[model samples]
Target chain A: MLKANNKVLVTISAIVLFFLIAPLIMVIITAFGTDATIAFPIHGFTLHWFANVFAQPDFVAGFKMSLIIALAASLLALVIGVPLVYALTRYNVHHQAWFQTLFLSPTFIPEIVIGFALYQGLVITVQLPLLLTLLIGHFLLCLPYVVRLVTASMVLMDEHIEEAAWVYGSSRLKAFLTVTIPNIRASLVAAFMLCFINSFNNIPISLFLNGPDLSMLPTAILNYLQNNYDPTVSAISVLLMLFTAAMMLLVEKGLGLKALNEM
Target chain B: MKNRSAFLLLLPGVLAICLFLFFPLLQTIWPTLGGSGYSHFLHSGYNRNVLGRTLLIAVITTALALGLGLPLALWIARQKASVKSLLSVVILFPILTNAVVRNFTWIIILGKDGVLNKVLLGLHLTQHPVTLLYTNAAIVIGSVYLFLPIMVTSLIGSVDELNIEVEEAAAVLGAKPWTTLTKVIIPQLTTGILTGSILVFAGAMTAYTTPQLLGGNRHLVMSTLIYQQAMTLGDWNQASVVAVVLIIMTVIVMGLMRLVTRWLDRRPANA
Candidate 1:
């Protein structure tokens, strides 16, 4: 009976994995197809589609914009998030739970709602620039993960060491810089990369905030795919997936997989 | 001294949250109530339809995601380490891919002369290509495809943490496989299921692109309604009203989720 159950489980696993992986494989296959239209079972193979992806001006501009926005947003999130994480985890603030919830609520709300709300509030009421709006949206979106990871790391660290540093001669700022920052460096790096990936891949907010000239890569690809159907989008997607995977591997190597799992 | 530094450290995040996050949330509520009147915005027939459709799609997408994602997550949970890692990567591909790219891929796949219909016609599977795009079904399919990974990942987190010995012990004590699974494993997985379901529902509720692309002009989810009002109609008040309604609904659902999870957490230890 156990053997039969194990076999059934293995078969189920294989089927699920196959279904999940097949689309990506199909995407890669379609990318290399010599035919203009994307179709299964390629007649010939070529790298012209990938070449096209590079040649497209919109794609190039969008890629650069997405990189800049993602970097800026993640950096801003880290700057705000790291200190917030420190305060929440170390200090006994009044209404700490409320503060935590307030900070983390962005993750709980729907991205679409947040996007729309921010658009209405910023574009309509505040007249914020599109770039600034995008920055604000991405920063809010990525803040929760950074705070959660950093706070978790802080909670795991021994607080006595910080207290000892304070008792010895270091000022609170000096102690935090010398002790807490170094202790949670792994979590901070992980938070930065995670926030970067999320900000980079984010679509809902970008869709709302993307202007004519300031289109992010995802929005550009979206618009392109809407008007045109070809393997160029697939090629771009393949590149994105590989890039993210490479980053994940790098993060794993630097921080350890255990830290990521905790995140 | 410690308190001062802590406050200083927290000031940036707090200020950002207030100015960008909470302030906008509060501002979203006013137009819904303040524009004309609460009843005027609330009773707007067009807004009602948008809200209804948004809720329906959210609920439907959540159900579908749970249906497809649960089985896959369970299957994944039982996989060997090497196989699980590979499968994890595959499952996360849709997530890592730009949402615009994925949704557009669906547009191509489900379009009038797209791959699926073309294949069906080529194989003589049907007399003519069935119209698959620009429909609720297509929206549901695309949204499920988009959000399934979130559900699967959350469920996997819950399932992986569960102790398997209870199921094994139940099996050894003359319980059938189905009986053990239904009675033992699933109850323990409820928290994970709830978390995944809530996340999926939230994603579906706020989904703009999938429905916009796939549902076309026929269907209007809340996000699209807001877009239409603000951008197309140039009615910021109406748009803000819709946006406010979306925010309120999301908050209510999330609050309910928390209540349910808290109840579950407080349940008798053995159960």
Candidate 2:
């Protein structure tokens, strides 16, 4: 009975896997099609779409801009998030629960509302540059993930190790650097990678904050699809998936995929 | 001095959050309350409709996601290790893909002469192509597809952690399978269910791309209306007012969730 049940589950899982992966596979194949319009069972294949993706200045520029924005936002989130996690773990701060909930409130709010609010605040109140507004929005979105992972790592750690370091007459900063940072290195890396991917994939904020000059990759793809539903959009999507998968693998190598799964 | 150092450690994050998230929310409220001496947003005709539709869709989507996800999660939780991992990755793939892309695929499948219609007509199940696109049904279908992975993952997480010996003991005591599930298993999963429902509710309330693409211009959720007022109509005041109202509603819902979870935690174990 158990063996029969296992066989049934495996079959169901296979079907689910096929449904999930089919669109992605179709996208990649369509990207390589020689025909202008997307069709299944391609007549011929070439690397022409890849060439087109590279040759287009807009695509290159958008990819570069997105890379910069994602990197900057993730780094900023880490810089701000690491200390908050440390404080939450190491000290009995006032209203710690309130602070944690406040930090996480942005994630609960809809992206479009955040985008609109930021637009109004920036253009009307602060009059900051579009790039800066986009950065702020992305950072706010990524902050919760960083704090969550870092705090989880802190909780899992043995408190005695840090106390032992302090007993050796190590200063607080030195103790943190030598003890806490080393223990949570894997979580830190995982948090940074996830933040980077999320910032890169963000669309709603980019849509509201992007000016004539600053266009992120997702926004660019959205515009291209809206105006012209072609295989180039598919090409872009395939590239994005490959890039994200590669980055995830790199992080897994550095840390472990197990840690990410825990989050 | 020690307190100062700790405060300094928290300063950057607290300030960033305040300036970016909380301050905008504060700024939004002021505009709504006639901070600039303009009470233009006092009327609630269109705002009420948007709020009602947003809540309606959110409730329906949450129901559908739980309905599909609970069974799949229960089934998967009973599986072996390798099968579990493979199924997890399969379920998570749609979540990994861009939301816009997923909605667009649904569009292709649900279009007038699309795959579903083609299949139905070819099989003579229907003589005519069904009008599936640009409707509330399409929006719900897309949302359930998008959010099912989250619900399943949450349910699976809770179900996996449950001690099976309790259920087995109940069965040995002559309890039926259904009775064992309801009495022995479900109470333990209240925390998980509450957390998962809140997460789903929040996501559904804020969902933009799926509804926008599938529901067409005829449909208007709060988020879409906010976008229209700010971006399309160039009415910042009205947009701010609407955004403020939505934010307040979200906070109230979150608070209610916290209260319920607290109450559940406080209840006696035997009760």
Candidate 3:
């Protein structure tokens, strides 16, 4: 009876997984289905729609912009977040917990709020450039994630290693650069991957920040969907999924998906 | 390191949040303070209804996510090491993809001649293609899909840590399986449940792509309404007010979640 109950549990969970991934699988299939429009019973499979995705200028530009913004934001996140985590962990900061809470608070707060605030605040109040606003919004989004990843790595490292370097006449800065950073290189790389993918796939932030001249890939796809019902968007989505999936596979391999699971 | 140097090291991140996050957030609501936007939210039945609907959808999505995700978590927790890793990867896969792609996939699922309708019709459950797309139901489906992964990921480690010996103890003590689950297992999972629910509920309430793609003009959630207000009508004041209302509600929910988690943590001692 116990064995039977366990079997039932597994089967039900598998069904739940099936339901969860069903849409993703459908996107892949629909991308290869008949072009122009989607119907229930897809006719002969073809890659015509996939080809049509690249033919659109908006999508191409959006893809490039997403790439640039994600890379820029991730790089910025690392530059800022590495030292932030280092300070919080290594130095005696008053109310370190409060600082940690404040940084990670972004992930808790709704992105819609963030987007709206940036739209009015950056565009209207600060008069920043459009691209800069988008990058800044993404940097905020990526910063907490970077801090969390690096902090996890920091918690596991032996303090003796850094202390040894310090005893050998290494300055705190030199010891950190030589002893600390190299030890947590994997976590840093994982953090960069996570931040890059997150910024790349973001919508709410991009929705408010995206101007007429500057649209990210996800926002552009949405625009296409608004104008057209063709499976072209589906095709582009499949490609995006493939790209993200490849990156996720890399993260899982290197970081063991622990970086993702924590958040 | 000097405390001052440590503060300096933290300054860049603090500056980024202040410059980009807090300052922007304050500015978005600042204009609405002297305007009719506040009254509009208070008196506007239409706006309140939209807000209520957003809350309702979020609640249902949270409930469904818990219902579905718990089982998945339970099973994953019980899996062997190898199966556990593969299943973990598969479970986390949807969240890694772009929001538009996931929402677009939902559009296909809920479309008129789409996957669900096709199955329903072929199965003879419905004589005609039920209008599933562009409805609140579609929004619920999409939100649930969007948030379910987060719930499962949150629950996995907590459930895995649960002492099965206690469950077996209950079962051996003449407790039914349902009783064991309800009495023994669930009480311990309060932390995970609270964390996941807050994340999902907050997420569903503020979701953009899923609702925009699935809930068209006919159905207006708070997020889409804010978009329409700001982008379509260029009414930044009203949008700001709506943004403030949404933020207030989010803060309340987060506060309530913290309270509930604390209550849960403290409850067992009294028992």
Candidate number with greatest TM-score? 3
| Pairs in steric clash, model 3 | none
Candidate 1 chain B: minimum summed lDDT over ten consecutive residues — where?
B30-39
Q: What is the lDDT of residue A69 in candidate 2?
A: 89
Chain A only: TM-score per candidate? 0.95, 0.94, 0.94
Ten residues in sequence with the least summed lDDT for candidate 1 chain A: A1-10
Give lDDT: candidate 3, residue A263. 64
Tens-place lDDT per residue, model 1, A1-263, is 12224665557656655545566666767788887877666678888889999998899998898899899999998888888888888888888988889889887667766777788778768999988989999999889989898888889999999999989999878998898789889988988877888888887788778777888887788778767778797788778777877876787679754455543
- Deviation (Å) of A218 in candidate 2: 1.4
Report how far off residue B120 is in candidate 2 (Å): 2.6
Give TM-scores of the second chain, every candidate.
0.92, 0.89, 0.94
Give the distance in Å from residue A243's predicted Cα in candidate 3 to where it truly belongs: 1.0
Candidate 1 vs candidate 2: the DockQ winner is 1
lDDT of 3 by residue, A1-263 (tens): 12224766768787889888877887888777775696545788899998898899999999999999999999999999999999999888899989998888777667877887888888877799989999998998999889898998898999899999989999988999999999999889888988998899998988888777899988888888998888897788889888978998788778678767766
Q: Which whole-number lDDT from 0 to 100 does residue B164 have in model 3?
A: 82
Number of the top-ranking candidate, with lDDT as the measure = 3
Which stretch of 10 consecutive residues in model 2 chain A shows the poorest summed lDDT? A1-10
Pick by TM-score: 1 or 2, better one: 1
Docking class of 3: medium
Pairs that collide in candidate 2 are none
